[model samples]
Target: MTILKAMVLYKQEPIENNPLIYSDIDKPEPGHGEVLLRIRCCGVCRTDLHIAEGDLRPIKLPIIPGHQVVATVEEVGEGVQEVRKGDRVGVPWLYWSCGRCKYCRRGLENLCDNALFTGYSVDGGYAEYMVAKADFVHPIPGFFDDRHAAPLLCGGAIGYRALRLTGLLERGEGSLGLFGFGSSAHMIIQVAINKGLDVYVFTRGEQRQEHALQLGAKWAGKPTDESPIKLDAAIVFAPAGWVFIEALKKLDKGGRVVLAGIYMSPVEKLEYSLLWLEREVKSVANVTREDVREFLKEAAQAGVRTEITIYDLKDANKALQDLKHGKLKGSAVLKII
Candidate 1:
């Protein structure tokens, strides 16, 4: 039996409680239609923090807690041919879904009731080895190295999908507001700038505001401050629902606000006047495979670059702390291999 090092979350508790502990465990093997991967890197996401801090309920206990996996396909299981040995690949949050479900049949697998999520429902990639459904693992483009591509699997991909829901795909260009200049917002601002959209960023941290300006944002300021111009669309990536309310007040008539988190704190009261004049609000759900592919393609073509702070796999808890306190700039990624 092969032994591997992994950071296992034994309980759903606060990060201060040290929920995740590093341990030596049996290496996993690929099952039928699955493939084994030697993990090189995994991006730390807010969702991981949510689970670790008990904001999101855990579906499985004693599970590894990471999903933005950048790895090498080390082995293939029975009937798996999508990837060959030594191929570089990525594993994202969407683990598996029953194709027979009506949501799946309608190409809305993200909303399927039978969907299983990596790091939440099953074991994930905060380890030396990981097993992934062959079809769910994506082929990483050669342009990005392990650290950069790791985040695109989740943060970047979700930001891409969420941005699409804001009507940018149909309208082409507009004034955009990104509330919370965190990991997802960093990638989104770059893509929006690449598309020639005027982007205004709102973050309470002066450092994040400056970082957004360096990324070519038309303007950057605190959420309490106002945009010089009304936005055609807004996307809220923060866990606080108050960002939605604040962003709602900045939209142009007929503008839209897309809330992009899997979980959020309760929103304060929404005034009818803020949503008058045909404005709309919608929340983004889990991403479809199509969204991932499309995002990867467009991101590559646009030469999108991700700013990240690297941490060793052993320091995942510390990394989570930095994210919670906004100590780390850009995105956080764990270098395991």
Candidate 2:
């Protein structure tokens, strides 16, 4: 058996407390319909911090915790025909879903109850070697490098899904509000602007607000600040429920807001005014394979740029700590073998 280094979470605790253990473990082999990969990079998402901090409880213990994966295939198991050896691929949040469910039948596999999630339910890419379902693995576009493409596997794809769910493409001319200027919002803003929509960003902290402005946001302000112009749509990437109400206040009539996080702070109260006038509210649980393919193509073609903070794979704990404390400016990524 090959020994590989991985950051395994044996318990859920605060990120600063060092919940993940970096140790040498037996490298996993590709099972039937699976592909073994030599991980190049893994993007550290807020969701990873959530798993570490107990915001999202782990379904299993001693699990590797990284979902935004970019790697090159080293081996393929039986029935794996989608990708061959030496192929560069990405493993996203949607690990694998049962194809028999109604949600899967409706092309909404993200909602499948039997869905297996990477890093949460199964071992993920915090390790140098990872095994992913061949069917679920997506081919990385040639333009995007391993480190740069890592965030797109989760933040970029899911954020693009949220933007699509908000129906921003439905209206050609209108303002779009982005609540929170984190990894996802930063990428989505460029796509929205490229699509000809005026992007307004609502976020706290001058650094993030300035980053938003640098990304071509027409306006950037705190969540409490009122928008000068009503927005046709909004996407709440922040985990604060109050951001939902705040986005609604800025949306025009018949507008929509999509909450993109798996967890969020409670909504204290819902005023009638914020939800009336055919305005809508929705949540994005996860990303579909279609979303991954579409976003990668579009992102590659549009030349989307991201601010990246790189860390060695051994420093996974530091990356998670930085994410938990809001120290990261753009996206945090682990550079592995």
Candidate 3:
């Protein structure tokens, strides 16, 4: 029985306590319609943090947690035809959705009730190898290398979904506000700017603010600081609910606020006036296969680049701790190969 080294979560606990246990598990084989990947790297996400710390209840215990995966196909199972061995692919958060569900029929597979999410509902790519649904994996464009491509699978795809939900794409031109300047925002700001939107970034750290400016954001300031102009739309990537409100405060009358986090702190009571106009608040549930495909193409065209901090696969716990404490300047990637 061949074994593979993986970071497994036996239980949820504070990331400070380092809950992921390093272990040698039996190597997984590709099932029917699945493809086995030799994982090159996995991007550490805030969702991983939430799952690790118990903010998002565990669906599968002793699971390997990482969704933003960049890998090469090492083998394919029965009925898998779209990809062959050595093909580079990316596995995102939305692993597989029941095509017969109402939401799936409506082309809203991101909201499918019977969906199995990578890393949360199933073992993900924080290891040497993983098996993923062949139909769900996206071909990693040659525009990005393994490390840089990992963040795009989730951080970029979900951010693109949140941006689309904000209705900025419909307008073609407007002031766009980003409430957090972490992994997603940094990449999204580049796309927004390329689309001719005036990008305003609100984050806590001076270093993050400068990073936003460097990424072509028109304005960068703390969440509490007033933007130079009212935003036509905003996306809150921070897990704090207060930042959601802050983005709302900077929005124009008909603007929408899209919450991008999988888990966030409880929002305070809303003042009626803050939402009195045609304003709307929506939460991004997850990403669809279309979202991943479109985002990858658009991001490549826009020359979107992810600034990453690399960590050895064994140092995943430290990566999550840094993410929780705002210690990372950009995305964090676990190098598995």
Candidate 4:
């Protein structure tokens, strides 16, 4: 019964209350088809905040909450192929999806009913060690260091999925609106800029707006502010449902709004006019393995760089607290290694 230090949540509470307790727990071993990883870094996410505050119902209690994990494979279990010890890998939100499910068979594993989520359903990387399904983890790109790669596993991958859902790529070129300037949206804007899309950003914070401008946004203002031009597509990264409605108001006819949050507040009742004229709304679900792979490649090619604020492993609560209050300028990463 080897012990390892972890920030564990015994119960859900407000992030301000410091719900995560740092303690020594039994270090997990690599089960069959799984691998043991020595965590290097983990990115703090809004989803982690939601789980802390009980916005999203917990699937498992006493969980170690961190999904954006960058680690080195320390050992491989029986029947594990392709992944070897000493490989640097990343574990994302979608931990495992039953391949035999109908949704998985149809290549919609992100929507698999029998899916297990890292950090949510099982223990995740807010620790010195953890075990993950070998087939589910992805090899981190050589160019990105551990801290930088952490955010890409979740924010970059999911944000990329939201961008694709907007149908902007198929349309070739168009104006794109991002309704937040946080971790995910910032990364998405870089990719959108690379595609030659005119990016407009809507966020409340002055610094965030400036950050958006610095990242090549054509326009940056509050969510309530009117866009200079009608947008062909918009992605709302804020958890507040009102931001979703605001994006719709600025959309051109037949444009789409893709909501990127894993858990969002109840949306305000939408007027029929917002949905009229083929204006569409869609939500980004969990990321599939394909989404992760594709996003990593695209991010690497686009030279997507993350603005990160570093934290220590024992200070997971503080990291998430800053995240909840919007104190973080960019992604918050725990430097565990």
Give the winner by lDDT: 2 or 3: 3
- Please list the residue runs of candidate 4 whose C-alpha ends up more than 4 Å from where it truly belongs after superposition: 265-269
Candidate 1 clashing pairs, residues 3+ apart or interchain: none
For residue 194, give model 1's deviation from the true position in Å: 1.4
Model 4 TM-score? 0.93
Weakest lDDT window of 10 consecutive positions for candidate 3: 267-276
Candidate 3 achieves a global lDDT of 0.92
For model 1, the local distance difference test gives 0.88
User: Over the stretch 49-142, how does candidate 3's per-residue lDDT look in tens digits?
Assistant: 9899998989999899999999999999999999999999999999999999999999999999999999999999999999999999999889
Clashes of 2: 0
Candidate 2 per-residue C-alpha lDDT over 1-337 given as tens digits, one digit per residue, 9 for 90 to 100? 8788999999888888888999899989999999999999999988898888887867878889999999999999999887999999999999999988999999999999899999999999999999999999998889888888899889999999998897767675678899988888888888888888899999999988998898899999999898989988899988898888888888899998889888789999999988889988899989899999889888887788877999998899999888877788679999996
The deviation in Å at residue 51 for candidate 3 is 2.3
The lDDT per prediction is 0.88, 0.89, 0.92, 0.92
- Write model 4 residue lDDT over 1-337, tens digit each, in one string: 9888999999999988999999999989999999999999999888898888898899999899999999999999999999999999999999999999999999999999999999999999899999999999998888788898889999899999999899997676999999988788888898888887899999998988999999899999999997899999999988898988899999999999999987678986989998899999899899999999988887887788998999999999999988877688779999999
Q: How many pairs in model 3 have backbone atoms within 3 A of each other, for residues 3 or more apart or on separate chains, i.e. clashes?
A: 0
**How much is 316 displaced in model 2, in angstroms?**
1.0
User: Model 2, poorest ten-residue lDDT window?
Assistant: 166-175
